[model samples]
Target: MARKKTITKLQILNAAYEVVRTEGFGGFTARNIAKKMKCSTQPIYLEFKNMDDLKNELFEKIKNYLKQEVYSNEHTGDALLDACINYIQFADKEKVLFRALYIENHLGIEKMHKISLDFAMRLMEENEDTKNLSKEDKFELFTKIWIVAQGIASLISSGLLPMNEEDIESNLRDALSDMILGARYSK
Candidate 1:
């Protein structure tokens, strides 16, 4: 008798990640994941209670992946600015994932906003430029910079803009400077 092959939850999650990474949320189904893993859908069902459970886990995995692989590694010395650049670079590099999570709203707009706001607040606490600002000012600064970053990221991911690293950095820096100046003087 042949031995049975057992699939683990981690394996299913990884396959699901590949599915989402390639086909976006539209293809994020157990059947697609099973096909990607070269396994039967039975294994996926055995590993996960339902697609929603798997999807929730997958979103967490993606968040950690972004934090570890994309955001944390930026070396610009400016936490918030580095985050903006990282967001843009991630959009350029992971076009499918970027469109799925951000543009197509698979990550949920409110959740994305909360995540961005929390990350911006944390980064602002560490940034010399915005750290001392009032919470309202910090939010204003973050909102301005994030709008610019999102515009650039959206255009780049959609293939309408082909910008180099220098231009990206320059634009983000200019936006950051302008926002910071505006926040300071608007009082």
Candidate 2:
């Protein structure tokens, strides 16, 4: 009979996620995860076909983390702007992981862009002002806000700028207002 597994697949994935969280994808390896898990790499290979499979799982976990944890910040009336702040805060906090996912392109640009777009759409749906916007306008305004947020995130994550909450709020508020007004005029 086949032996029952000891280390769970989730445990392995979690270990890998932690590694990537602290060290980025460059440190992703069986040996690294094994060190983190305090176990042999055998369980890792047994659970996943290869590093790519493990990475794919990690990516999904990251997505869920973003939705359920990062974006679930305390509501402050302006849910859309709060969501942008949450995203930038996440980047500031998880610099290595953010750099890996966004800057290093280790997670693939297309997937990240789609995920960001989807998250923005969900936030828009929750906002009273944006909830009724047409798809084109929503996409246009969201794209603009996302661009600004991403720039701020990238700068903060890369240490180009300090993680100043006031600065983030100011930049995002100005951009959000300008984008909304521009959309109104163009409409």
**Which pairs of residues clash in candidate 1, taking residues 3 or more apart in a chain or in different chains?**
none
- The global C-alpha lDDT for each of the candidates, from Candidate 1 onward, is 0.86, 0.87
Error of 2 at 167 (Å): 2.5
Return the TM-score for candidate 1, rounded to 2 decimals. Answer: 0.93
Give one digit per residue, the lDDT tens place, for model 2 in 81-178: 88889989999888888888888998899998888789888878887767778889999988899889999898888889885787788888888978
Which parts of model 2 have CA positions greater than 4 angstroms off? none
| Predicted structure 2, TM vs. truth | 0.93
C-alpha lDDT of residue 1 in model 1: 95
TM-score per candidate, in order? 0.93, 0.93
lDDT of 1 by residue, 67-162 (tens): 778776665778788888898999999999999988899878776677778888998888777788999899888788878999999999899999
